[model samples]
Target: MSDPSMTTTGTMTSTRSLSYIALFAAVIAVFGLIPKIDLPFGVPITLQSLGIMLVGCLLGPKRAFYTIGLFLVAVALGLPLLSGGRGGIGVFVAPSAGFLLGWWVGAVVCGLCMRQFMRRMPDAKGKSLLIAAFLSSVIGGILAMYLFGILGLMLAAHLTLVQASLAVLAFIPGDLVKCVICAVLVQSVVRGMPAWRLDRD
Candidate 1:
């Protein structure tokens, strides 16, 4: 197998890593298809973002970002892979589009944080990995998600910043839960198959 972070030339493997990226993207779409809770705020709480966190932690920052980019491309292609089986460009115009767009940034940020912390710690056990993953999800991923989500809400729902923030409060609990779930799952994967992490660089 190849390091997802590098190419045959030993440079960053942006192009060659597409296969792994596409695989994770398909996984995201498939996870999105499962029936899930939809908050009244128009943001559906799905496993897709949780999956995003795993890709970030396990695949490292670059590959994780690429995977999420591919996932968005799939959604943009009218795959009906989003929550509630929604598809097409209209999804981008929807209120939850901010969250969708944030997926990329969130994954990248989360991956970066994991890489930084994991390096300092060097041997993150299950507990350490869980804590690192949790913080990464909350500070890096969810924050980015909310930033984009709030912007989307302001535009799509036609609310002021304050109003949008208040409106999105409904999603806080669900997002926290999702973050926890993601952290645990990612830690478990690391413990079970540490080799699966394609690139630590």
Candidate 2:
């Protein structure tokens, strides 16, 4: 395959990139259809974050950011693309808005880390992929999401940091489950279907 970094000058090049962005956006949205569990704390656990991390690891930062941004736009436009099939402007304005916003940042962070890992481990071993997936999710998805989520929880719900922290703590078990799922899923894909290994590019 040709190098993605090798830019060709023309309108067609931009169009192709846009097409990829759209395809990835659709990927995230379609995956949103999977089962979602809403916690009592108003934050729901969904597979969309898993999709976000996977897209980032495969598509790189710029593409990953656009993919997630597009997903958010669709949700804002009343599409049932969010957890619990919830959507529309109301979702964006809700207390969970911070997490919605954080999705894009998380994608970028995950993509950057994935790219760096690929660079560092050009001929990565199986165990390395698992570690990369875990670290990428933690640093990229969880932490980034937590920061924005806590801030939004404080602002939208009028809760203090301590209170919000306790509330958000409710999702720890779920988040860890997601992390485990991410690692296992990524490893399986990369090992079984080498074509899914985006690092070769």
The candidate scoring highest on TM-score is 1
Worst 10 residues of 2 by lDDT: 192-201
TM-score of each candidate? 0.84, 0.82
Question: For model 1, how does the per-residue alpha-carbon lDDT over 1-201 read when each residue is reduced to its tens digit?
Answer: 886655555544555577678887888888888888777666766677777777776677888877887777777888888867888888898887888878888888888888887888877787877898888888666787789889988999899999999987877778888789878888777778876552364
Which residue runs does candidate 1 get wrong by more than 4 Å? 1-16, 38-44, 196-201
Give candidate 1's TM-score: 0.84
**Backbone clashes, each candidate:** 0, 0
Worst 10 contiguous positions by lDDT, candidate 1: 7-16
CA shift of 8, model 2, Å: 7.5
Instruction: For candidate 2, write residues 1-201 as lDDT tens digits.
Output: 865556555557678668978988887887788887877666777777777777677677888888888888888889998767889999877898998878889888888888789789977758888888778878777888788888889999999999888888877667766777877887887788775544522
Query: Considering every candidate listed, which one attains the maximal lDDT?
Result: 2
Q: What is the lDDT of residue 7 in candidate 2?
A: 50
What lDDT is obtained when candidate 1 is compared to the true structure?
A: 0.78
